[model samples]
Target: MTVRYAANKDVQIAYEVLGDPATGVPLLLIMGLDYQMVWWPDEFCEQLVAAGFAVVRFDNRDTGLSTHFAKGDSYTGNDMVDDALAVLDAVGWSDANVFGGSLGAAIGQALALLHPERVRSLVSVMGTPVTAGTLRTLRYVRFGTVAKLARLPKAATREQEIDNLVTVYRTVASPGYPFPEDWARHVATLSHDRHPRDPGTTVRQNAASRRFTVPALSTLTRPTVVIAGADDPLVRPVAGRDTARQIPGATFVSYPGMGHNLPEELWPDIIERTRAVAR
Candidate 1:
């Protein structure tokens, strides 16, 4: 429950560590676009800790308690990758196992490619490879969903903000998994109260993802696992498969009826798969 800051060049990245570092492999969890580290469920982190991992969850630059940027001064995706390395250095770990989703997943892939020595293992969940070409042609099968996300209404009031977030979760959530409306509302409320909503930061992050192209990944030697939701409307399952196909000896897993959101029911499987790869 203790929060700390790690210095990365000019920025101070905020992070929280769970479980004893002396106990197990260091596991770093990276969250997605515009989402803070708090988006990672406390229970999910606890389960990984109980499974013998020292978990480190952090706010990626413009999100959470980390450093905020001016309108046009945001860092690019490669800069964020170095930020991850700085987090490891701050914690006195030479290397660690990494798990990321969405944007986080893209960062994890870049980390494995650029700094292979710093990553012990990698797990990418509901993420796609971020190449310049992919960004140029980024279109989901559900074009209507993309349109709705693109035109999400701005909320001037707290209640309206929560409602907006609820709508978002509903729009992207897996049809087969129960949507936890109440929990989503709670998280939205906390996020709204904790930090100022910055649309520009999200825009810059998206641009960064598009600007930074991943190097050829067919030669990646790190143990990697790619997880995709069969019904994911955001990134799509094909992107996940494509990522795994690029990495040699990497494992790919798809959950039926799952979407962009990770449900509590699939956590056990995620933990087991992550542990297997870490071994």
Candidate 2:
């Protein structure tokens, strides 16, 4: 799929679509930190389409083909929300069922809190709640994994970038499931060739996310599904369970041997639960 641009004030958000909106449920797939829309695997998206969804995947600002920002550039979390709304607007979807992964799931939580009407349903995968305080949020993360990530050697070329990405993903990959090195390489290559990622994007996104003032998750009225990986070394499974507990009647499901990565074997389970909530 080719990319399309949505104007959010001055920033141009990049997005792509699969399946027709008229024929299926409107679903926006938001990726996580430092990742682009291409990270949403093609086969995974085709499966979503086959499962009766109009899938729209997008690159957040300062990532992918979206408008870049300079170091020290400051933006409110509302800007991030507007960027998402812009993509939905450009796609002609007034509201959508959102499936967000990791940081993207946090963004979806923020969306649900800030503009509840705009979110039909939410599926949060391997993520913490935006409503959690800084200290609380920190408690859910494993700094050992973070420290290892921080220690990765910097990439100076295209090949180096792809290799680094593969390494990073492998670090958090499912221990019980076979790692899809080939698919990871293909995604890494596309991310590298599609548009070289700006080194500062992660910092900028983290800053913007921190600026968001989220209310209690208990306030959310929409149906939600929280999928946690029991083997996740980053955000602990308890976080998703806690998030589910906060929402009125949110469903919480976890898989053993599933780490931070989403193995293809679990797609059927994830999609079916998400479909139930969206319906």
Candidate 3:
């Protein structure tokens, strides 16, 4: 079921619940910036469901059907983390396992750090550690393109938008990795159709992350698993290795040939691992 709820920041978060609501342990699945819940892929969610997890997926503020804060409003990535927690509260779930990828993983780290009691376990996929050096190169590469895309006027044509997004996919997406172009185009269209892209917020969020380090990595007490793509160029394996080292009891899993994209092929194993962590 799709739902909307007001957050403390006054943003209306958009979310969808998957699996049998009454079955199994609840798991909150958060996607990256500007990503919708569907990005999690049906098979992945279903695999988790089959593994006895009720999954909740959502679009963050300024993305998908959620409330888009107007340009020029100063906010922090920390606020985005709070937004995740708010979504959990609004959904009426007191505690749940957390799974996130890329930017979503960073937010999940923030949530687990800030609200330890609310997260039972954490699965961070292709995510970076909270250090300036860890992400400096990535921010440099991604910031300019995202800033340009976000500045696009609301009147931009769908074809033009898709073209711009295709370029973005080429850059940010794992090189040599096969992208579901049609699926990505559809997602881009839906994002623009739902809300105007805000250049300022995207820029702000990127900058804010530099100052934000997850100090809780050292103190994270929950069962944790860090998944890194062997060929991921952006968030290199070094980052994931460092993150795992910092978490006292966390385990690290690096795939042999996987790229940053979470292909449907990996869902079964990922779901199995996630279920094991929950157990």
Task: List candidate 2 stretches off by more than 4 Å.
Answer: none
Ranking by lDDT: 2, 1, 3
62-140 per-residue lDDT for model 2 (tens digits):
8889988997797866688788889989999889999989988888888888888889999999998777867888899
Candidate 1 lDDT over 1-279, as tens digits, reads: 888899988899999999987677899998888888877888999999999999999999898799988886856889899889989988888999999998899899889888999999999988887552543337534577878977888888878877876787788887778888878888877777768568888888987776565578886789999999999877678888888998999999999989988888899999999999999
- Pairs with steric clashes in candidate 3: none
Taking all chains together, the TM-score of candidate 3 against the true structure is 0.85
Q: What's the TM-score of each model vs. the native? A: 0.95, 0.97, 0.85
Candidate scoring better on lDDT of 1 and 2: 2
Better by lDDT, candidate 3 or 1: 1
Count the clashes in each prediction. 0, 0, 0
lDDT for 166 in candidate 1 is 71
* Whole-model Cα lDDT of every candidate shown, in order: 0.85, 0.88, 0.73
Clashing pairs in 1: none
Native-vs-model 2 lDDT? 0.88
Model 1 CA lDDT for position 102:
88
Candidate 3 per-residue C-alpha lDDT over 202-227 given as tens digits, one digit per residue, 9 for 90 to 100: 66566655555455578778899999
Global Cα RMSD, each model: 1.6, 1.1, 3.4
